[model samples]
Target: MLAAGGLGTPAQAAPTVTPAAVASHQSPSAPQDLAPTPPMGFNNWNSTHCRAEFNESMVKGVADVFVERGLKDAGYEYVNLDDCWALPQRDENGKLVPDPKRFPNGIKAVADYVHSKGLKFGIYTSAGTKTCSDIGFPGALGHEYSDARQFADWGVDYLKYDNCNNQGVDAKKRYTTMRDALKATGRPMVYSICEWGENKPWTWAGGLGHLWRTTGDISDNWNSMSSIMKANLELAPYAHPGGWNDPDMLEVGNGGMTDTEYRTHFSMWSVMAAPLLIGVDLRTAPESAFDILTNREVIAVDQDPLGKQGEVVSSEGGRWVVSKEMADGSRAVALFNEGSRAQRIETTAKAVGLPQARGYTMRDLWKHSDTNTAGTIAATVPAHGTLLVRVHADRNWAQYPPALDVRAQDTVTQAGHIAPVTSEVTDLGGNAARSVSAVLTGPEGWRITPKSATSVRALQPGGTLATDWHVEVPTGTAAGDHVVQLTAKQRTRSGTWLTSTVPVTVRVGVPLPPGESALSDAEPLGSANGWGPIERDRSVGEAGSGDGRPITIGGDRFAKGLGVHAASSVEYYLGGACTTVTAQVGVDDETVDKGSVTFEIWADGTRAAATGTLTQTDPARAVSADVSGADVVRLVVTDAGDGIDYDHADWADLRVTCG
Candidate 1:
């Protein structure tokens, strides 16, 4: 997935790759000692992007930042250079050389300078004849042995071998040649395979290199980071102590994402044991990014001797919980909120492979505090935010009983209207609970699902039973908050019954003031077109293909509102009392850092509020339209650019002003 701009020359179309060919070049066993844990270092891609800007002085400057910025003390070591760092051709003796202009003093001097700082030096080359950004560089296709000898002679300690003009050779064969060549160099350089996961490297990369790319190059945006993170989770089982997964470089200081998103990115990467190759301009990174990149406590979890990759133990309602077993028997966990609004994520110690006793002594990694781990640990995570913690065993009897998670809207419409309710019951105990059931109790006039006992045959530990309920606020219900309770009961294999109760407060909202309600709370007209169910307070999931999800939440512009993808046209009724419409519109927050979505509000077929064109990174803005004499107002989000590659448009606080 290298962008056209990333390639110095047009990529030749190659036929489909075969598994046999990929396997032919793979080694029986890659040196397990090369990367005992994920490599921590900085690379020169996100900052320089393979341009001629990479020179000996630049590498030296990065090395200096490594020490001055406290990175060296935080376990960061190697300082590597990516594409565009070599000469157009080799020397008379067929030795690849650095560009004389950029590295007039040569790479040996740069390696010496890096080593002088008590750090390691890394260089980049390609499997093809020409590098991805060969601008003035030749790749290491046929000259692997010679180039390896030269790199070893230059005192290089790490090598990032990429895929570029590879002359149609099999991926395994091309990469194998370099790996064997490096082994022959007699230098202990860390070998990183940069095949970009084209041939399912996770399947056969065990002994090919210390680490291999799990996906194409990552960008400094939310969608790109999120997709890559999810993909990495699937390949978790294939990772080991020596052969770790490399999800490209770090983008913590990259400006495309907000502080919260960056933390989510870094936290996920750390939990999964992905190599943390810093990809930002370390010299001028902001304090927040600097703190995030240099957090030693977080780094300890990654460098733990157990070397186990993290897994997603809990996933529901746009939230995911990941857990990694540490060497000391403690567990490191991270909760992520992928939804647009503030979401609540909960999990029990027993559910994440932790033995349940009374509870656990948990230390919040981000909050940097000791907190409660009693019954269930729950955190209200902001959109794209993460809550990470390290949990130590307290009562280690290995008991995880049935844990229940229930959430409903804080407020519901007047009587006779139904609101959404989601309930999840899990058996966190070590054994399955037979005849599991849930019951609800509430005030008069409110109707709940099943209205009777809902029976589940059995609830196994780590298994969850999900139920969607609707609470109808009877026609004459009071406009105030009322407490409703849901109780879960289960019997263990020994026939002992245990029950847990969760109480929720649901408020009945008063009728809308004369003019109207927000589009999220308003019903879509029959004349409108809707994609899936009109979302409220949550962003839509990406479509996976085609134009991708129509909307990016655009950074949670408002606390409450509808979420939907674009090319969407929907109208809300306001009656004759509405005077004006005001709403904030932006590309949703989940965009892929490209393309644009158009937002428009039509008043009787006349354009009123609109955002001409907004790229993925654009923030949400207020758009006001005059609906003073209108009966129905329309909201239309369209693909504005070449295509809606990443346009997740959200119109928040879409309310009509009445006088």
Candidate 2:
């Protein structure tokens, strides 16, 4: 199912889509054009993920937003579908079909509605015999020609063919079959080959389709986005006018990455001339998403007629420049600073493969203005930020708004635990920002407190502000990936505002399973001065366990357990999220002067479970405690009687249960 948590609020009741509402789902002239520039539009995968959130009504709403929000005017025409739309089996005539319940009116019914809004329609399919859905035989494997004909007849203008359940078929042969099928239909539907970049499709996908994927699926995270871009940047030569190298779908408006990260993502995609198909629900996207998605200047650079991809011209000191050559002799340069703080990036026109030395108009692509620069252009790029500027004889660049840098350090976190998030923001751009404040947004009922001051009076260029925030995760919070955005808002004197966002992904682990382990199985963290990573049956004072110090703790099923001497403790992550822990602790019968020892379990800062002092001849007592929300678990043994005489204790049959 699609993870739509980050897109927007929950869906609302919407108008149903009907075939008659749209006029036969056909374009007036067979859609003469085919992604001359990378196709731009909204895809449901990132936002809806082929989950129940996507329906006929929702898709209709997407088209409605496309027109209502000026996305159509911005050239984002194709509204694509990714997966999970097909029924389990084909019709009696061997034709694929959409899920009747969701698309009650049928595929053409929705396609017609999309066409009525002056937008193209796209559908998804897998090359493997069984689409990704193993339960339902929905893959378009054997029915390539028939399926293509059916789609063309239904006015489907674009096809997003995926690779899944291929059953060992050749990628070229399978995708080639669909390409030929689309050609046979005589309909000019844009074919998007989605082979997941496994077969090095860029090498052979020159004319296979309008675009071919050069990487695997892209997650809405900084690492996922940047990792793919780093790979696609190396394949710029393979991208041309018709055949494009697809990095993946756009994650803008998905609420996963920060606005800055999304800008970087969009900028990189444009630089590569990859497909600009957005994977967010446009209906509920915020204005920030709108600004990033429909930036005419950025879109123009992407749609440049030359169809040349930008290459990594220079990379050093965590700063890099990727510039693309346009047909009009202008160059689109993306100056990126991947450093932790602000970096002053500078380069000469000749450095970026420009023919002339000077006399080029350097326009700030993001700001949509000409920067005043001639021979050498320099700008301070923010951390994890980009300065997209088109340099040519058009004009010069202008002073930039103060760019802030926000940072945080949490990737995986635990529910019911409080973790500290730290950020060091700096003013990387020209002017001073008046009243800079750190704004935080996250899940419902989350209590966030900044340990240090959250706001600063004035942040001048080169000045940095630090904020340490603590987030308390509530119990019962679902386990999965959750994003928290830390934004630094800069209110300037000129009424100009700039906001920098840092996205924190917290992956909560699942609860611990019920299992018993021998005391020897616990991996020890050597904390005792030296010689202490106590192994199973090993004594704490020596190289081996059980140092022959008269320690013998046994149970009905087994005999060995953690043999701990006085003043020793062991730690564990509990292997998983444990809800309860139980164990037996006692002194071995062999200890003649077995003094006394106590067993205790500590979680975080509180002692959760404990066992009474045990002496020789005392039956192994079962000690149990509720650790429903515990993460780090520790077991400690302490001497209760005379100085380490014979205080050997064993914790046996330790069992942890999640329930």
Candidate 3:
């Protein structure tokens, strides 16, 4: 039976797409010309999949938002539906039919409306007998040619062919059949193979589709995002112009993660050269989400003419450096922090494959500003965040202002306490900078006072300047990551003013009392779990707070500790007052002898202690780490080379000693 539904929003209603309207549009270009660069657009699966609200009006409104919100101008051309847009069964003529309730005027009418907005329209179907949705919409398995012809008649410009209920068919054969069918239509629709990387589509899909999913579906969380990143990072060579390694869709503007994490998500996608498909409802997205989604500099990297995906240059202890060569001879570098605490991540321009020069221009993609670096590229990147920069050999050092390599260290402060913040600037240019000055500014209601001379008469080439400020956080200010802006300015010979700005993340936390105490009793200064909230005195449960059973590891029960999923981190600001941290760590008994994990404790970006692989069959291992004089303590768990399934880990009886 066909289910019916109305459009979700009542915004500017579009008329039914008529046959004449379809006739008015011309056929698209050849398949090779489909996506010269990775496609940038919207897909509804991640946000509103199979929901009653995902109707014709909702899609039409998306097309409107694309145009009204400057998304089309920003290079997002397709408005794509994911699943459940059609009837459970095809029509008697063997044509896939859009649900009458969902698309009252039929799919062609909606495609026409989308085309009217100067945007391409895309529909979804599976290679198997049924779609992935619960309703089991009819798929284009044996009826590929008929369905493709139906799609062409309706003026569809893109097809998202999915993988579900494959019925033992060979992945390559199934996808290739659809490709042949679509090609036979001569409508020039872009094909997106949604095989979820199970068959290593990147190895073969390039010749058949514009893009292919390199990973499974992505969730709106740090773990899901980073894990997918890890999977796709090594496949850079498989991506090229007209074909991409799709890492699912963009989860930006979704409320699951913080703004900083969302920025990292978008930045990494751009660096990977993946499709930039909006996966959230644009009508109600927050301005902050829009800020991340509409970052032109980041988008430019994803759409770079070179079409080269970034590859990991180095990854150790949760710090990752990825680099991609741009068509303009520049390289996009991403300093990623997969850890829980903010730490200084450093890399050299040469390390990222840039040719040696007098100085390199390091353009901060997020800051939209240029800075000079002799060779060292470094910044204190926040946890689960990314510092994306474009570095290239300086062509005209004199034409630009002296490169100011400015950065600040991560600071941990308490409410109403004055903390010393330092900013270091080096002149990486061949020319001197006159009237050099620096300033530090804090958030509103916080006071920042200069502690050292903020100005120097002149900064010669290769000279370095260190400035200091005392930042006082207001009492009662919420604890967490706070921004402290460091700005450096200088005057060029042409009387032009140049300035470089970097943000220092200040964490405000309560000091631990003198004596041993259970870590679960105190709120984490920062945390990112693979599943849900960091559990207190319980096993890591399914995706909610206080949902776990008692904390138990390998038949050993504990009363005090933190339970977390694998690939998790719980950080605390120790303020150099903690002496040691001890814990009994192992895969939780809740997994019933089915999981494996490794636990590590980090102090100020250095691993203090680590446990060998502990599976559900092994007893909890006692581990202790010296945290004396360390500003922060981080507890981390990793899925031991296996998948994260049943990887519920426990830091049983975890305790920290302070003062």
Candidate 4:
């Protein structure tokens, strides 16, 4: 009944944990077949929490969506519920009670409905005396046996045991009590320990739980998501089959971050082999959200039978390259950019532990295309984006033309304005490509003409071809995100043809007022800060807007400015009417002489002004960039060789003049 295995019991007393003890810990003996892959499901905490909408109908609708929307087939099997599902107090019989108001038909009926849909049902409870919500529902700290038996009777296949109001009890003992209780019921249930990594549960909970939260609760923002990812990325060594290091639930469809940032969130989590728990409401979710959640290729990497967590191959200046070894001898690689602008991150097949071969076949998980490479694996990853690919050595890859790396700049311009979209094509394979040609096309009624040569007779291996296109937006085009396409084609020596298509995103903006104004006074076409909002006339705070003090750099205070963190960008539409942009840029003094950053201003994608490696001790430096005939201007900040820790940067006295 207990899967025909024995689990050792925890010690009666909680032992103090030391770093040496964590390092010397042995592998967990948890059931290997319970979750051979990370569990995929929908957790209704981020989008619903304890709201009235989180009721029986909503829970059943989730099960329906998973079946109708292809999620169930994509390997999402569990429909989980987070806190506040039960009555605030226990019954006189010393048993927990489900909130009758929320579950009018009772939790057992809901579990039966979910099971009828061919999906497993999961429930949540804390290891303490009370749950995490303010309503304070009863927990299973001392009632593990009773609660476990009750859950088994209700047909709960997964149990997410949380840590709240733990009452100073030992973390290991608290979780082990519940694990042993579940075993006693003779019903197999996946155990998730939600201790928030306060006691480093990954060191001890592997054998006690199927997955453990490695960071604090995740919020729906880039700062929160990226920081949690960084924390969990370092604990890959502790994860294996039947156990995993969870960064937190997936926030892919939450409104706090852009779709690009959400993609990064999902990409990094997949590479890390973290659980794919959808944290948004599926009933009213947009198609874009579904597009991201159901990316089967990315999901495949997460569900690889090998169960090897991705490890960082290289990280420098906010650019990270991570690789996961797959069971089929392929490596899933992710090129992630945490910077403000586009950057090229590089790694090699050998670097990812692949055997030497004549060529390697690469499959882009996002683009859904295949390319051949000699060894180099590189991409100019966009800000807050990840390029996910699968690479494996192929002896016959030479029969195909090396995958041409075709890409274009993501342009931001005003309606009726002419913008330049530069593109590049490179042959990354060992074989030469013949009859190489490229073309750029825009939406209907938009004129797209090439300004450079678009064809070549022969392209040697490793050679690059650059092309420029002039994109003229019509006067009445809508002011929203638009798409442009760049297509490249080539032929192998065997007469086989190959084509690569790349999509470039263009954002149309409204022109600013024709006068001198504080840069922060106008809305930016795009803004991406490493942490928190881009503050107006204040230093970059850790959270909400207006939370920062006056913009200060080297003890100098400024009343009119913009505050940002390193790896930040703020872009504004100029309508080709602005003359010059000026600002005093330096590291913010809030960091107490501990942070370093670089500041730059770009006019129409060209660097017009820059500051060299400014530390907190450096005085504010003046920077001015000419914007003659430029349609857009961008203020940028990046980490200075060192990491981005505490890198609060400021653009003091920032002013833009137009007309």
Candidate 5:
């Protein structure tokens, strides 16, 4: 139901009712009468310009026509005068005044005129330095408060705050600033924030304003209307009462769109819970335009107070079907054929979350009629046309049997003494390969190698493999689990070799020993060295300084290229004598593995204290490890023996804390 205009405060009491009170009072559960549903109104900007050159005769002429055409009686109450109705400048006290030439009798007289006709008056302004029409005083930045108060004084019921030149500042803050200012005026003016959805205003603007523009400026054309509707459908979840998602103003009654397209536009907007601000020349609209605009069934969904916007469930070609869950446990569906040829669209209740149902009532909003149906329903929609239906099931409905569901399979993992490896190759071939030789087109260090020949190939639980390759896990390679891949070349008849590979998971036993340590205490100087100084290739032997002993690890020793090289340790002698220990190390790119590293420790030089290793089968990755123990500890960079480059390794601050 729509609201009638009145000046009573929100908290004011109704006139005393005698023993015969036939009218229903406001519900106690629903406080603060919401602005009203189905905002039926006509806006001037789209059809006629209200410039300074136009006079009072023009304004009265439009108002008289609105009443004569039964628009006001049909519930289109607000005769909103958009931009350019106001002068280009403010008065001495910086207050906006209506254009004297356009509004000769003053804004107060115009307001009285509109009120006498039992209609509300709406005005437009900018949230920026200039209005879109390039007229009227700017009300953005610091002038929101002053302009809001002035608008309230002029008896304005609604404010359309446009985003013109108001850039740089955060949009939320700017819109909220004006909202708070408007609230302070002791007037309940509906705040419309026009930001064009930059940063998705619907996500946050609901709490700040009554409505927000969800798309770019809409033109009076079918293409513009359809594009705006499509964008709004994707953002339907944000519409609700006290706030709405605006797809610009109404263009149905305008001449640019055909009758078929206009029907689709109205149905789509209703399902989207978009504002129905009529932007046509209402006084001179044809009968068909009125019929399209006054479709009762479509308006029911738009005015459903539940305020939920419908969403598109599927689309084939240009024919699309959208559904919205109504507050009454019913579903509102729209079948739209946007293509050049008519199409038949069908939807089952089960597909729309409604299972088997009996005695279903389908209401055709445009035809203002209801049809009974059972189970699935189909309709033939003309090109650029729509068929909107609201479906309700009887209480004795049953659910349908479920359909078969398919699940994805998992890949197997390999086992061995080889180091655990994980690789992530970007911008490589579209597929993954197992053989080092297959991916070794550029260099040898780019592939993964197993510790031995006995390792069996096992696929990962997930992920598609790029190639097929051989697997070999050698005995006594290592004492722990390892992952390896082999690439094999399949020669074509033309002698062109293509590579295929598979990953092999191997589990072994002998874990390698931790590396040796040489340097001493490595500490930051000057208040914990918040930003330490450790120049490349530099070394220091001090317990408290940020610099530590610099040890260089060589890569030319290991068969795969290089293995773990340097380590640092602190000793706790008998009789409670504790000396601080620290170390720093550098790598010549060849000494470190780009993939993984491990850290370990040995107490009193023999018994193992802690142990761990890291491996990267892919050369373009890095991993870190932390090791700590009582007497001694070691850090190892495994897969270091693998033919990979570790050119980016710098270890610092290896220390021991004693109890």
Candidate 6:
């Protein structure tokens, strides 16, 4: 249950049951009754990071703006002071004190000023020995209870706990310690965990805190803000009432972000159900910032009682379509354009599992108007802008049946032709190569080549076979499916041949909207050969002339000149605990490979732990392995290889999963 704060006088604490107690008792198991929606607030981190010159006057100034501009009435209740608020040293009792220069009136005075404006107050601290502000304030450390009491005494309504300078200890324990301590304080304060992806707090922090930072710190620039927003879309499934996945603080209203970017930022956050912690200097924000922040339709999504964050359903170029399930069974859709040019983003109600109902209510979140019709919604979003629309069934609407197309591509080829089998063609494991002969027939002028053919022993009656022939399909092929035929021939007794045929189909790849790549382009860690040169397409590399160390790609190279193979092969490592070896390979620019490519690490050249595969079916992908075990260790990349250019690889992301 949401804990209660403050003490009632003896006269008010009589045996009479209050309305709040009666309502609470009526709902015994509702999660919303316990946690409800997240508290809306404004934080000072993104725009002003511990400006040493800031004082209580500055705090009061920002608070005054919140009140005068109706931000507090709009549900922004907390004025959070982030980092560098404490003195350089704690008192002998291990209690942190506000900095005398910046907070001369003490924390209580600042809290009082905020309270007078009908807003709550928040403070920041670290789970480690030192805060990010570099101040030597006492942390939760071994004094979780003491620190909790101190914060309570200071009337802090919320606490932002940072995870910096605190390592070697289990991260969750550190967070839980503070949570328990705060619970014991008899003072209800919101807990915000600031652990940046170390242990994805979004998956488990719901029981321990009010919110958790899901991404790294956001800057005031559009690139950083948009990138962080894009990453947070994948984490939407975890956001809910009482707990939220924070994408740092808002960069909107900050001077650096463009007006269009600011609108997109606000629209995206609302769709994601992310906390609306405005980080701008409110006292000086332009009118546009206020309009973007206070859009009722957009704010409705963020403040939706259902509290479901939006997820990216489809994205191309700079256009992205995201959807969030609302409490009323309606879906909140956000069409975002992050490109330099305006583009039309469209989505059918069926695509989002919605009823194709005519005359449905489509309220524009930013414009605060209802759209006329809604079977299929399309909007020309401005560059770096967004359109948020809440789709709901109206009594005057007509519903239609849903239509969906489901099909999978069945053919694979290289350089626009059926590649022949060759003696050098091997599986991803570097095992013995496999050889086969195939014949392909299609429209006139179409070309066919063998990729792994061992020998040209026989051919069909009317087919032409060439070892050096490679087909090149023109760019921008028409959208739709096209078919061709492939016939395989095997040499038999008396110079005769056996032939078999298979059908192949090709579909034109869709281009991204403007500034984005398809999902097929995302690369994960620990992929084999993820760090090789762009020209070498082969999976495993050939051992160098000397020393013959196993070729490694992803991890930090210890023995400077060691070379990883171009084909695929497992490598063993031996050395210091800090030393590591990695292997990675890139996929072709087109085509996505399915299934995980697992890497097993062996200590002393023996099995240590069986790690799961780094799975991907995305185009332009890379995976790697990190070897840091003691003595000797072996790293293996599993699964069969696919696609062309496994020979002439490209440079991609190379990072160690674990070290």
| Candidate achieving the largest lDDT | 4
Worst 10 residues of 2 by lDDT: 6-15
| Per-residue C-alpha lDDT of model 4 across residues 572-614, encoded as one tens digit per residue | 8887889989989888887775778899899876999888899
Ranking by TM-score: 3, 4, 1, 2, 6, 5
How many backbone clashes can be found in candidate 2?
Answer: 22
Clashing pairs in 3: none
How far residue 83's Cα lies from its native spot in candidate 4, in Å, is: 1.0
RMSD of each: 12.8, 17.2, 8.3, 7.6, 23.1, 19.8
Residue-level lDDT tens digits of model 3 in 562-645: 989877888998999999999888887767757778998999879999987888889888999999999889898887776666
Please write out the lDDT profile of model 6 over residues 107-163, one tens digit for every residue. Answer: 999999998988899988888887776445556677789989988988888899988
Candidate ranking under lDDT, highest first, comes to 4, 3, 1, 2, 6, 5
Q: How many clashes does each candidate structure show, in the order listed?
A: 21, 22, 0, 0, 49, 54
TM-score of structure candidate 1: 0.63
Per-residue alpha-carbon lDDT of model 2 for 1-659, expressed as tens digits?
A: 11222211111112122445322222212132586688888789878865787889989999999998888999899988778787887889988878887799998989999999999999988887776543644777888899899899889999988888888999989988888888899988988888877777766666568788876677787645775787688777666777687888999878878898899899989988988988888878888999999999899988887889998888885588898999988788898876544466767677777776434556677766443344465555666788888876533222434445455654345678876777677764445667888866788888888899888889776677888878887887776546677788776446866565656655454434455544355443222211223435432334344353323454233344565555556655543356676777776554554457788887644798887677876777888877656655677776663334445566666666643
lDDT at position 582, candidate 2? 79
Model 3 lDDT-worst window of ten = 4-13
Can you tell me which runs of candidate 1 are displaced by over 4 Å? 4-28, 134-136, 395-659
Q: Rate the local accuracy (lDDT) of all candidates.
A: 0.72, 0.70, 0.83, 0.85, 0.53, 0.58
Q: How good is model 2 by TM-score?
A: 0.59
* Whole-structure CA lDDT of model 4: 0.85
lDDT tens digits, residue span 331-424, model 5: 8989888754345566766666554654466666776544444545455566578888887775532121111011111112222212333222
The list of candidate 4 runs beyond 4 A from truth reads 1-23, 255-260, 407-422, 441-452, 468-485, 491-527, 539-558, 565-659
| TM of each candidate vs. truth | 0.63, 0.59, 0.87, 0.79, 0.54, 0.58
Residue 304, model 2: lDDT of 84
Candidate 5: how many backbone clashes? 49
